[model samples]
Target chain A: MRKAYSSLESLRGLCGLRICLAGSRPFKREVNSVKSRAKRLGLNSLTFPRRMYLFAAPALALFLVFWVFPLIQMFFYSFTNFNGINFNYDFVGLKNFVNIFKDGTLGNSIRNTLVYTIVMVGASNLLGLAIALALNSNIRLKTLFRTCCYIPALFSAIVVGFIWSYVYMPRSGLLVSLITLVGGDASKLNILGNHKVALYGIALVEVWKGFGSTMIIYLAGLQTLDENLLEAARIDGCNEWQLMRLVKLPLISATITINVILSAIGGLKAFDYAFIMTSGGPGKATNTLMFNVYRIAFNEQLMGKASALSVISFFCIIIVTVLMLYVMNKREVEL
Target chain B: MRKFRLKPQSVLLHAFLLCFCVLIIYPLLIVLSSSLRPPGNMDSPLLLFNQFSFASYIRAFEKMQYPKALLNSILTSGASVLVIVLFSSMAAYPVSRIKSKTSRFLYYFFIAGLIVPSQMVVVPVAQMIGRLSIPNNRFTPMIMFITCSLPFSTFLYAGFMKSVPVEIEESAYIDGAGLWTRFAWFVLPLLKPATVSVAITQGMWIWNDYFYPMIFVTRRDQFSIPVVMLQFLGDRENPAQWNILFAACVLCALPLIAVFAVMQKQFVTGIAAGAVKG
Candidate 1:
């Protein structure tokens, strides 16, 4: 015991000396490494018992049984003619995929999903960044305003979708009421009912419920911007716009990447608004990929085809996300 | 005159922010006011409180079976978050501490789950649930919630676990403390912030999620808050029971909003920590 105490004391003294000699973080990390190495030499212990793996067993079992196994089964089921009811099903070998494409469902849903993603990514980021900038400034009631902004985000998508549906209701909706009160023609203002406008309308609801989170993230990023750096930029006679364009945007490029990619991924999985508000409605105009999968699987009872569509969606999401991350990372480095 | 001399840019910024806040808050206020008015009264949306009453709340409360649904929501979300926090934190302990290729691979394996959208697996999950003869109960969605949340929560706890210095655990180990005791007493307490993050994020999601429950639990009694609120959707009998629908919406949102009111700072911090760090 005395020997162990002496060894630990010596190691602490060594770490102290190293900190005094080189005050850098990496240097300090090296000191920690040396101390840990000393521990590995048996002054203390570092062995994770085999039983520690049991700590991971519950989650792993759950993941394998519920998530991974299901995913694998989905890929397999996609190749077969399983209608979700019968046990006897044959492997069709790409026929389900071919059917989706041949039926125009794939093209329409993909187009809608892409458009919805684009709208969400554009609108949410812009609005969020704007609000984040405004809130980050020396504004009165800032917390109150921020909380109010986030109120919509706190509500479930069902509530948001329901409220927005009512807000966009045809004649006596809040929107139409406001437009009429402002003396605009409100006769033909049906957002959720119009095939061309339904997708955008639901996308707008998502934006409303979503931008607050984006703003919160952007605010967190902006708060990390060095005060001295901003002051230096201002001291260099840069105007507000120039400072924002030249310094702030570049500084928060990483945050922008995170926000944009998150929004895009979120937008790609757009189902709640479509499911609740429009029900992929107004003649399948708002048929997002996720909603389409739901419709195919449950409504049409074509689980095999839906599985195929899900596989396609899985690949599509992975590809789009990877591409976005790549492009955003490139822009981040350039900025 | 000096006191009134606000900068033009500052004024413009405030004005823009104020208008934006109004735009965001007005719709919510409309819902609130519509709920306050008597049922079957379709007044102008412009009216705030021409006649205030809780009649709609009473009606919505009964119709949506708010008590039962709220209990189911509370049970599923609360229990799922508890188990998720425990399991993920435990799982992260080994992944974060043990230095091995397997550990590294396991870490990335869980992280990869963040990219795979849950909808991709829903079809098979449904089929599996059916084949397994899983009952449409609260635990069904609870299990699904736990499974889905594992990856993110594990990643989060693992990130935080790295920040916890190993020396303490080593010292505890040297003091003849076993792994379970050390983890439960020392490491787990230190991971409280991570636990809270996992809880809040996963709790909010499980509480608000209707999709999984909508798919898994078809029974009316087993329905969660959001799923139960679906009754108000397209109610063809009344055609325009806006008051009851809006009232139900408010009730569905009230619990979370109430929690947010108390723990606003934590909510923001939780989100920021998850997003920025993760």
Candidate 2:
């Protein structure tokens, strides 16, 4: 038995040696055959393993169940008179949409949301760009100023809104106190209470909390500007204003696009301040798209109406986003 | 020695920035100071560091159920972020690796969620939550957060995953390493930067978002920090106690501010990186 085992082991070793002597070229040929075979069979084992797709199944399942399904159901509900409490509701068709339009809710919220987006996109960009320019330059205490400026952005909207409501409070508010300190008459400074100024008031609060982040993005983009190019421009007799307008603006167009789109989207979702500070009040003066949705859905118990409103806003948002992206991309390419 | 001379332009820039900083910071300082004043001191002067009392803190703490809300906030947001990172990276892997029609469809499918804001679908989602009898608890809000975050998180992960060479993964696969093993060992470690971006940005949103919790969580004790602060909103019947409300705001914002103070570089860089990349 021992002799047979030794002879078997030697035979195996001889086979291994023979295979090694001949294996290298055949191995390459075999791999190439496998590759060609896989290609012919439309089976890309290297890239498209059937087993690999299983990794995405969990997230995809969650996405479909939680996100896609809900959105589809939202569309369905927009057509029915589902009052949120009852499961047995009738199809109302276009009635909800017509009702919202006739009552002026749609037009009012759209106008207010547009105004808010304009203010946010305008004020946030200008202030953020200016701050970014100043901070990007050679300045003292750069980190300290940046951090302090960003502190408000760190706080929750609830906190920021609450604080600002107090600031905009009547004679006892901080704005009044500041004006008094500066020797200005401060009697008629009820910003949040006045219907004409209420929307602007909340929009400014949005800007205050948002501009820091916008500034940071602008600063990042500004840092990428070539210092040598600026120096060369300076050598060619470009003033600071000329340098900024001519050299800096064109280079950072991408960042401006990003900030504008972000602030626009954020402004369109203006609910928290209107909800917290104004309660969509001063006679629906600050009733934004989102707050109107909340008011109709929760307070009025009109889920169908709210869903219709949401569908309108959804189309509005998607169109606005696509349009902005197209226009901005064109502008960026042109620049 | 060089003469210490301030250039006029530099001086003007500094002065303007100083006023801007003051404008940004003074309101927060007012909240801080008002929170420290004695309870019922609504008429207290808006000066910094004038009072040394925690009376409002104590009152607000009890009123807002500080300990419970803080624990809920930490647990929910932390769990949501952990799962968001894991699920999103896994989902992004195939989308990035495979070159097929299905993969392309899935990539755009996830990216489509970016434009459709969650509030647009809140009605049906809320109804589905009720109809399905999902328990309105802290974890419920976590599910909402994770679901809402997956779009951007997956977008981020997919962008990062394209940069990862397939050679490493293929080699590992040929070496008899299984899919999960290769992913855990090879892909995840290399994805540390994207992971940090995901964690910081999504973590900040989940932590600060009161909207989801306000909609989903019905139990008072299950309220997150921002929702708990909502309790201080005074209606006509009950006037807002300004001091206590300010105190609650401070308490609510304290943890994030502390984390930011420590991880300022990470927070700033992570957000900027995510924004730029996305």
Candidate 3:
């Protein structure tokens, strides 16, 4: 059994190993397959401007009906105290919005959400930059390293939350077991149970899952960089750190901005991890605004308050995006 | 010429990268280990694969109606991708080729949707979805997915379409090719990469998305993977059969993992390009 388990571990880790081994050899074949499949399907090829309009109309109608109508509907619903079950709803002017300040869970959720966003964004970006730079150097098995790192981002956030909850589980979890092995009495320390530590614990998982995609974006930006500028900087005796600070950093500012806005919006509206792992538990430590939206709507059945919260959050997302873009645009040094 | 050599610096760099990669991959493996362990006291949290059994998987598979959930997720994601690719590509063509003020305005209008996070709509959308009499079929979520994805797809398709030379389409027009033939034969093939990009990005989004289906999919039996798998975690058998939970997790993630492994290059490129707008 021990032998078998050991072999499984070896084989499992080597999953990426086999993929890396084959990554370079099968490129043309995959493209050919896609091409052959696409080539066989040439139905109803239209080119006129009017035809273009015709083709685009269905998607537009879906957009108008599903997306636009929903936004308008939600806006009006926020002004009323509507339960999900009712046709009749009374307009309680500013009452739901007034309730926002008095709600006990509201402040904690906002603070927890900010902490999650700031910490996850900072840690993930830093880690992403480091890995991207390391792999950009003369590293062997780059494909394997990248593939392994990026595996997490491909997963749904709920899956990530579920997996990390197991990692943070006490007594029988990986962290506690490791701590116990290292001769520390860490069994008593419940990372997810302690209200103070729970949010950051989830944040750490977010970083771990998210940083890989950040690195990929950075790598893409790095690869597209003008080599001449880099070589010229190298000739000017700018060392690695200096080179990165001066040229590489400035060059990838757009990518950095994109990642920042994405991570910020992602963190602000985070629901899956809090919902799956903690369910905003240990006295509202991990409850994000988005999670509270779910709680208010479904569990508490305060449909109106939920709509109000969503409207507030929508504005928050927009304001943060605009501010971020402004700040990032200022720093951007277009070469 | 300097012969290529793994210097001390390179060695340290490789060490750091290897450690990071292991840290990233290890948690996922541990879940697989726990899932395979016999259903008993959750001991040996760091257990690699000892006492591995398929019982948890069997239990999870039966309880979650695994095959049906898988089929439902696949159907929804596939239909969403097809609708998105066909329509968004067509939408982008006019916007890309025409270069009119209306087209340019339309482009930014689609881009405008990015700022409006779907969270705002969830409440009313849920309420509205409640009223709608769509069959409990996957169509509701599929339509929602299509509507949500179009802006991003159209954005990406328009961007890529700009790079496609116009002379070919113009000559095809001059060669007496009908508008449909020219578009189908001439333009569509040229837009294949964008199609692939849109398909992949939207496919992953629809497949992995939980929020939409949770609101729209009312029936337990008709649930998608994320919604159904969530049942295993919720108020269930009071003992919290975690081995079964972990098994469901593995099963839920396997299809996506397989997709990523197969199309790593296109998926990465497509996602990176898509992320620029975010």
Q: Quality of candidate 2's docking, in CAPRI categories?
A: medium
Displacement of residue B258 (Cα, Å) in model 3 is: 2.0
Where does model 3 exceed 4 Å of error? A1-51, A104-106, B130-132, B235-240, B276-278
- Give the CAPRI rating of model 1: medium
Better of 1 and 3 by DockQ: 1
lDDT of 3 by residue, B116-206 (tens): 7676577666556666755655668887788788888998888887888888987888788876687678888987777777787788868
Could you tell me which residue pairs clash in candidate 1? none
- Give all TM-scores, in the order shown: 0.91, 0.91, 0.88
Error of 1 at A245 (Å): 2.0
Q: Give me the runs in candidate 1 sitting further than 4 Å from their true place.
A: A1-45, A49-51, A333-335, B1-5, B130-133, B236-239
User: What TM-scores does chain A show, candidate by candidate in order?
Assistant: 0.85, 0.86, 0.83
